[model samples]
Target chain A: MNNYSTFGTALHRLAILCYVLFALFPLFWLLKVSVTPNDLLYSEGVRMWPSRMSFEHFRFVLAHSAFPVFFRNSMIVAGATAVIVTLLASLSGYALSRFTFRGKYWLVALMLLTQMFPLVMLVAPIFKMLSPLGLTNSLTGLVVVYTAFNIPFATFLMQSFFDGIPKELEEAAKIDGATQFMAFRQIVLPLTLPGIAATLGFVFTAAWSELLFALMLISGNSAATFPVGLLTFVSKFSVDFGQMMAAGVLALIPACLFFLFIQRYLVQGLTAGAVKG
Target chain B: MVFDATAGFPESRRRSLVDRITRHAEPYLYTAPALILIVTIMLAPLVLGLSYAFRDVHLLNPFSGGYVGLDHFRTLYDDDNFYRALRNTLWWTGASVLLQFVFGLILALLLDRPFAGRAIAQALVFLPWAVPTFLTGLNWAWLFNPVIGPLPHWLYALGLMNEPANILSNPQLAMWGPIIANVWWGIPFFAITLLAALQAIPRDLYEAAAIDGAGAFRRFTSITLPFLAPTIAITVLLRTVWISNFADLIIVMTSGGPADRTQIVASYIFTQAFRALDFGYASAIALVLLVLLLAYSMLIVMLRQVLMDRA
Candidate 1:
């Protein structure tokens, strides 16, 4: 029995190691190519690591290319979307959690329908709608679209988090002469900070990663998000693998940071949602 | 109480009516912004998009907004690429979902065991899910590039290929490239959800099973599988719909290239709208996909209901 348990432990550890390696390998490769000197890139082809590493690609991408502008644009759009979505989602989520009202069923159903159908379907119509408003080719346009796109999921997430908290906290405040909104603002919102953080991170990463809409809406490099810019860069400078990889690495940072922060709560939140449903 | 001189109602009745109105309006007030945005931004566009299917709406052609009933659908029916895209959608969604689910279940099972450094392991393994889909596509595309990436070289070394070649450009093998990238990116989602489900299963059930001389496999089959069934069903169903509509990786990595071998319906719709700039045809394709997905979802729900009844 002792030998058998030892064998099991070894197998388990080996399996875990494989998964970790598989998960990290592509990222590792991305980083590897990013740091490899242009001189050695072709000569040392398929190497796990180059003979010498350099930050020349990163420097070039940051300084010479339009990537910095793209990065800033992405940050602005994602940040704005995250803030707007979280704020709207919190209020609506609070309503969903605390109140039973008319149109509630339809509201939830409408959101679910949005998730089911393809957002690609809306691309042309939205372009038509926003074009007349002069919203195309603008970061503000991207933010607006992303905020709307992310609100349903974020609201569902926030609602799940709100559901986890006791209703008594708000109810007690309400009894103590606080309006329902006041109770929510002063009592409930403060308590769901973790949920708020998770929602922010989730929305930020989502907005940051959005591609098709960003591609369709924004026309030029000045307003291009990271994904669109990188794509165009790939097409324009197909030879600069090192620089493109460097840009890819830069794009990975904020998203990975946010993801690392929120991933711990992800399972807990989902379990809460599953149980609530 | 002050008297209401302006209206026929008394002061107390007016105050009560005001309170009632406020109480009734509170939830709507809270939800109104999100509702309005959803209507204008999402719902309205969705309705317009549906209408676009029956109209002649080209992005570049300003004069092409005339009603052309069934013209786009008729064109879609005749388009061989659309048919090919439909077939490819089935293959892509099926392979990606199946592979992701299997590997995800295994990963979740492995992580469920108490092991040293599990926290860091969990974080590292789940990191891929964080990589932006476009970056994931680019990263994988580069990895398959024979000149820079090691994958082709490794495959060649293993006698799996004739030469180190970029699989993304090979029509027969291009679909696999996106599918593989998809599996890598999607596995963590399934793992996370399944892991949550696994944790929710009663530990005492395993203990009881073991106490009754049930082996590990037996306990897993009797306890874990049964406990995970509902979660698996729901996640798989939702993921199927989501993945079918997901065109990011394919768009980025291959762009449905090499004679459109990787052109699933979603990507096909995107190609029509973005590349071809034919909004009408794109909407028509999208409508078909939406109907198909709804049918799939309805079928799954009914199947689950029938299974529940039988049980």
Candidate 2:
């Protein structure tokens, strides 16, 4: 029995180590290639680490490229979408959680159906619609579209979080002459901070990652998000490996940081959702 | 805030007609912003897109956007690429979802076991999920490059490839490039969800099973699989639908291919709209994909219902 248990422990650790390597290898390779000197890029090839490294690619990308504009545009779009989606989702989610009104079932069905259908269907029509409003080719348009696209999922996520809280807290606040909205704002919202953070983090990453609509809607480099910008880089300088990987590393930073910060809450939120479902 | 005059008023102090109306209108008020946005930004566009299927809405043609009356669909019926895309979508969605789910389940099971350094391990393993989809596609594309990446070299060394070459340029093996990247990116999602579901399973049942002399495999089958069934069903169902629509990796990695070998319906529609500048044909293809997806979803839901009834 002792020998068997020891074998199990070794196997478990080995399995975990394998997973960690698989997960991190691609990212590590990206970093490795980013810092590799131009002279040794191809010569070093499959070497786990190049003997020499430099930040020349990063410097070039930051100084000479249109990446700064793309980065700023993505930030604006993602940040605004995150804030707006969370706010709207909170209210709508609270409604779904607390009220039993007519059309609630249909509302949920609509949201679920939205998740199923292809968003690509809307790209052409949205471009046409927004073109008339002068909303195409702008950061604001991206924000508006991302928020609407994300609301259904965000609302469902927020609803699950709201569902985790007991009803009595809001009821107690209401008994003390607080309005329902006040009870929600002052009483429940504070307790649901983690859920809110998770929602914001999720929306932020999704908005930042949106490509197809971003591609069609924004043409010029001035308004391009990271994905569109990256594609342009690939198509333009198909051989500039170091600069592209460097840019990719830069793009990875914010999303990964936010993800690490809020992933715990996400798991907790989903656990609640899983149980309820 | 001022518009909602009765918003601040208590029920006892304001039992008047305005208060009653306000009380009844509260939920609608809460949901109104989201509903309006969804109707305009999502549902409205969805309806317009449906109409574009039957209209001539070429982007560059100033004379386009007229009623074409199923002309695009008639063309699509004979389009060999459309048929190829439909077939590829099935292969792509099926392979990606299956591999993601399998690896994810294994990872979840592994993590469910308590161990030293589990926190850091968990974080690292889940990091790939945070990589932007475009970057994921690009990084994987580079990884399969014979010159820069080690994958082709490793495959060659392992007797897998005849020589070091970019798989993205291989017509016969091109689809695998996007599918592999997809599996890598998507496994984290399935892992996270399944891990949550796994943690929610009552551990005392496992203890009880072990106490009854049930082995590990036996306990897993008797408890884990059954408890995981609902989550699996829902996640797999949603994932099937979502992945079928996903085309970023394919578009970035292969642009639907050396010979359209990797062309799935989602990416094919995107190509038509953005590359061909033919919105009418794109919408027509999208309409078909949507109908097919709806049918697929309905079939699965009915199958699940029948399975539940039998159980």
Off by over 4 Å in 2: B1-14
Supply the global lDDT for candidate 2: 0.92
Question: Candidate 1's residue-wise lDDT over A1-277, tens digit each?
Answer: 9999999899899999999999999999999999999999999988789999999999999889999999999999999999999999999999998899999999999988888888988988898899999999999988999999999999998998888899988888878988888888888999999989989999999999999999899998899999999999999989999999999999999988998788877777767676666
CA RMSD (A), model 1? 1.8
> What's the lDDT for residue B33 in model 1?
93
Q: For model 2, what TM-score is found for chain B?
A: 0.94
- Candidate 2: docking tier: medium
TM, every model: 0.97, 0.96
What does the lDDT come to for candidate 1? 0.92
lDDT of candidates 1 onward, in order: 0.92, 0.92
Evaluated on CA atoms against the true complex, candidate 2 attains a DockQ of 0.78
Instruction: Summarize candidate 2's per-residue lDDT along A1-277 as a digit string, tens digits.
Output: 9999999999999999998999999999999999998999988779999899899999999999999888999999999999999999999999999998989999988887787789999988999899989899998999999999999999998988898899999999988999888999999899989889889999999999999999999998888999999999999998999999999999999998997897666566677776777
**lDDT, residue B17, model 1:** 82
